[model samples]
Target chain A: MTEWEMVVGLEVHCELATATKLFCACPNAFGDEPNTNVCPVCLGLPGSLPVLNRHAVELAMRVGLALHCSVEPSIFHRKNYFYPDMPKDYQISQYDEPLNVGGRLDLPDGTRVGVTRAHLEEDTGKTTHVGGGGGRIHGADHSLVDYNRAGVPLVEIVSEPDIRSAEQAKAYVNELRAILVAIGASDARMEEGSLRIDANVSMRRAGAEVYGTRAEIKNLNSVRSLGRALEYEVRRQVGRLEAGEAVVQETRHWNEDEGRTSSMRSKEEAYDYRYFPEPDLVALAPSAEWLAGVRAVLPVLPSERRVDLARVAGVAETDAAVAAVVQQGLDGLVTAAVGAGADGRLALNRAANELAHATPPDAGAFAKVLRMEADGRLTATQAKGVLAELVSAGGDPEAIAAAKGFEALEGDVVAGAVDAAIAAHPGEWERYAGGEAKLAGFFVGKVMAATAGKADGKAVTALLRERLAGR
Target chain B: MALISRDDVAHVARLARLDLTEAELDQFAGQLAAVLEHAADVAALDTAGVPPTAHPFELVNVLRDDVAGPCLDRDEVLAMAPAAEDGRFRVPRILGEAP
Candidate 1:
């Protein structure tokens, strides 16, 4: 197989979580009664006009700032096209100018993908095609348009063609979603279509400068589908290239059920949108003071949080345990535990692994569990149990620990368990006395089992060594 | 300069779903060219420091509170549509895929 490289760029459209539609006062909600959210403005009645929503603009700016983009003077345009879903013949979108331009997102693997622009636009109404094969548009008998989502505010973030693989694309999207969520700009829910991805994929030989013809894969509603569709498209293009056929540039739709992309429309059939400046909406240029205020209010984002977590935990920046805690949104619990005097690494591990699913206990309770484990008041297994109970039912950690019978064994109790193990496993003990050092682990396991894991492993080892040394 | 030709008018009319006759296309072509000529007259002006204007007014950041106001009754809105089904506007069979 010849070496091939994939070049990918992503256009992510995230719906702003504003309370109303972009140009109208219709409630910007989803999954409500189909046509209940319709209004003259969103329905595009003849006399209706658009008034830019300030809250939507603020949300868009918050996204841009989070992505590290420059917020410039942007204007809306009428992208003239006709569709039944859009009662207006044209969509009100930003053309030559956009709210955000030229930002960069750094993936977890340290690949910097440049963002070309994040422009504001309106979402079209949904069309539920009926009597079709699987209800797809191609074989549908007819379709119904619900104008509820017609004027919902959207920010389309277009990335520079800098992604090298499907994994990087997924990482870029994950980081961007975190940023959007951190800044309270969008929920970024891919399942609900609040966040959608369109991937532009092409391939070339290794070290080639010019790219092969690219195919755009649309309607990648989830991150998993985004990566899978890009991979499938890249392989298809490489297969065509190796077969000595020229790849045709076209827009393709991802048939997720089939796990392949099918041609939607060719570039030859592309529409001439005839975009003209929207004469109703005026220029949107934020003053320096306003920009500063937005910047000041931005919450600490993921990248900064990662560094802070590593520093606070006294671990390497690439520590998987710390990274897992931060990625799972459990960094707050870990931070609170560390602040209340729990060992940072212990807190990170327990929160990331044990308390991952359960609700986190109070800060002081979590810290006490970690401290108890550290001070040898509880065995590691017993500490996890206490933490689990604390998560499932909020209470004093000590009371829960005692109630669960997780009390630490006294020294004599551990010694007695060690003697019992030695007496029961005479044959294994003989091998251990005959200079089989590996048998130490066997004895330790037996002692832990005998004591129900309440005895410390180190203490058990010491007692076993003392008792078996002379034999 | 003839900016709007008869063919151009016909193409735009088709896109706009406007079924115009040959005579109507020809008349509208000439009228659209006149309108373009007037726009060209404005383009020819010496406004070196002039900024591009999106609207007639010099307004920026005109916004409403995030609070949602009253929505029109669904039945009333659906009644205004040419055809209504299941409380939604019913159009002709859509031939192509969604944009």
Candidate 2:
């Protein structure tokens, strides 16, 4: 609890959303049947040639651009290692010549997490270390290997230890995940191991510039979990330092069940996996024509789009942020809304407040409905209704809402409905007149309920107050 | 490259998660040093201001309509799992946890 500062950085190994493995033609789909997606190139069969998946390169480039990193003519290198799952006995990864360097991830609070480097690599196959409740190598049983995920494309984003707290680390991951998924380079789903994280959490005396020995906590799968792991590690290190014990640098594993980090192993126990240039694969320093093609295809990044949303849509800063998170080209949505003759400010307000809060957890779906509603084919109420009707309907929202007759009613019709509700709710009406204006909401609800919410609530509220208060 | 101690080789290899024999570790110390020395060639490139490139494709958002796309069939995706119990990928019971 003392004033110790955390010097934290992160290494995020994101599985690119490439259809095929990083250096092979095998399908890169997650959750495939074990080993079924493997091919000669990925499985490392003798005499098989490996080719880079073009999508992997593009994805790494797009992410590089988004992070504001210089896209170098990066090259790949081979990292040799002997493990049960790594069939090649060496993983083909980038070392010195990474795709990006000096990039930054900007938080909502405007803190920039400096990017050390982002590199491309062919992922190693996964291994299940089977054994009794003991150490892995000393007393482990036979291991089962899954090559299905072996050749998946991966981009390892390494950040400078610029983070100061556990919360910032979490925000960094969340923001990075949002940006990556927004770029469409990856699904960025941690639940399914698409976005895997490892943190280098260290500490120093309250204002000391020198850092203490850091522990690397591995296999963090979620943003919240990453934050918790960092917090737990920080506390443990602080406790160790307080108890006159020095923190040793080592790799630790996050036990999600216990919400803490346990020592996986230490540097004293390691052996060399000599790294060298990969001979089988040709060096892929892209030509200018190719880089131009890739750059031309770059989507508007989340931050830039957010700024545009504020300037072009004339919405407040906070509202612009929500639309920018994963809806990368949300500026297009506003432009489209405006092109359809919808008021830009009104569309943004409705989309951010009403439509945003009501957005399905999946952002991609929310944007489509907003577009349809903004075009005036469907009303705001109809949009909400479509979301509800199609919650399990497995059909399109606009079509479903139209089928259910939930489109927005005009201003005068809403006023008439308000008149009718007053007559029907005489008891509530009496309460309002008898110094109980709090019942106003009840009457408004009655009108909405009578019309089945086809009326715009704002217009209905205005008309209700004008007629009911006799103004 | 000068020869490195087995201990140093072992230490670096361990950081990277490779269980190497003593001989392999020694061999790798030489190889790693040579690789690092070779990598110095990249630093020798003439003029600066060259941005390191990470990818080689159009960096646009491949936006898809947010309709629920088809997911893998439960039985089908799980069919390839080494072990599946109760609709999840089950591994050998892991011991010890974060304290």
Candidate 3:
């Protein structure tokens, strides 16, 4: 394959985590019954005007500030188009003027990607096509528009064409998602439609000064798909260029199952949204005090949290374990465990290995579990058992371990079990002591069986070593 | 200048989902050109120091607190739709796919 460098830019839209919709007082929630959250303003009824949701603006501002963007005065514009998903004939979004402009995202490898702008917009309703080819829009019998999500607030972050590879694009999104969730601006769930990505990919010869014509891949829902789609698009463009075919600039759809992209619409069919200033809404001029307030309450960001984890958890800065804990949102559990006098490494290990799940135990209870494991009251396997029990039935970790007969055995009891195993199997013990190190595991198993598996394997091993030395 | 052509009108009509005849497309082309001509006159003005105006009024930060308020009844809201099913607005089979 000829050497080529890919140029990629991302447009990420994240729904703001707010209590109500962007323009109306309807509840801004997910998975509710269809159209139950709609109001006149959200439904775009005649004679109805929008009142901007203050929390949405604040959340958008929070996201911008967290990304190191300068907040400025912004205005809303009516992007006129006709779509059934949009209850109104147009969508209210930001145009030339946006709330924040000019930011940068620093990936893990220290490459900084510049953010062109991050602006606020309202999400359109969802359309579920029925009675088609596997429920697709083509050849569908009809479509249903649920207005519950029509007026939800969204912040569309546009990046500069500085990404060189698909991995970089994925890292940029992961870091951005962390910041959004850390600051409570958005849930940033990719599986749900709360966070959506559009990738514009182009390729050129190595060391080229100018970029090639780009194709925009729309609706890359997952992070994996985002990277895969970019990779496939780059290869497609490169193939076209190598085969003496010109790459056409258009919108493409990523068929995830087929692992390829097909053209959705050509450039000529692009909708020229006649955008004009929204007359009903006013300018969003965030004052100095308001900006300061939002900034002051901003939580510790993901990068800072990773540093803290490295320092507290005693993990290497480049350790994948530290990144996994932080990325999985298990940093709080680690923090609580360390604060409760648990060993940092042990706490991080337990949390990363055991507590990494969709619903982890509360931080306080998880801290107790880690502290117990640290104090040697519970062995590693016992700690895992306690964690599982705690998840299914919330209770004290120590008590759960005790109920499961996982308590640490006394030294004398373990010694007694070792003695019984030795007395019962003297020939095996003699052979084990006769230069067969692997037989130590056999003896340990015998002792565990003698004690009904209550003896710590380590303690049993220690007792067996001493008895064999005396022999 | 013939800024708005008949083809442009037809494209715009297609985007707007308007089913217009050939005569209507031609007529709308001339009318839209007149509108654009008036907009061009306004754009030709020398207003270097003037900032862009998003709204005619000088109001800023007209926002409402994020509070839950009463919503219209589902039945009442669905009653106004031309076609509704399962408490949602039903429409013709959509041809375009979501992006």
Which candidate ranks first by DockQ, i.e. highest? 3
TM-score of each: 0.89, 0.65, 0.77
lDDT tens digits, residues B9-86, model 1? 998898778999999998999999999998889877898999756688887887677778788898888888788777
DockQ of candidate 3, scored on C-alphas against the true complex (2 decimals) = 0.65
**lDDT score of residue A202 within candidate 3:** 93
The complex in candidate 1 yields a DockQ of: 0.61
lDDT for A121 in candidate 3 is 95
Model 3 CA lDDT for position B71? 87
- Candidate 3 at residue A157, lDDT? 98
A1-471 per-residue lDDT for model 2 (tens digits): 548889999999899887677776667787766666766666576797766777788888888888988887655677765564566777888877787888999876667899999999877766565563443533555455667787688999999999999888888887888788877989898888888888998989887878899898887888888888988998999999989999989889888888888887774322244556565555556666767787787776666666666666666545644444325334565556656555667556545544343323233444556666666556566766665554445476556666787555665677788889888888887777787867778877887787776766666667766775683
Chain A TM-scores for all candidates read 0.91, 0.72, 0.76
Higher-lDDT candidate of 1 and 3: 3
lDDT of 2 by residue, B1-99 (tens): 464566877776676677998788777888887877787788788757865444444242222221222323445644655765444344554333211
lDDT of 2: 0.70
Docking class of 2: incorrect
Candidate 3 lDDT over A333-418, as tens digits, reads: 78877887778887777777876775778777888887777676776778888888998898988789889988788778888878
- For candidate 1, write residues A1-471 as lDDT tens digits: 559999999999999999999999999998998989988899888888888888898888988888889999898888887788798878898879999999988765546899999999999998887777887876676677789999999999999999998889998898899889888889999889999998989999889999878998997988899889988998899889989999989889999999999998775343478788888788899999988888898998887787888888888766777667877888888888899999988988888899876766788889999999999888888888888788787898789888988887888888888888889989999989989999999999998888877788877888878997655
Segments in model 1 whose C-alpha atoms lie over 4 Å from true places? A268-271, A410-440, A458-471, B1-14, B17-48
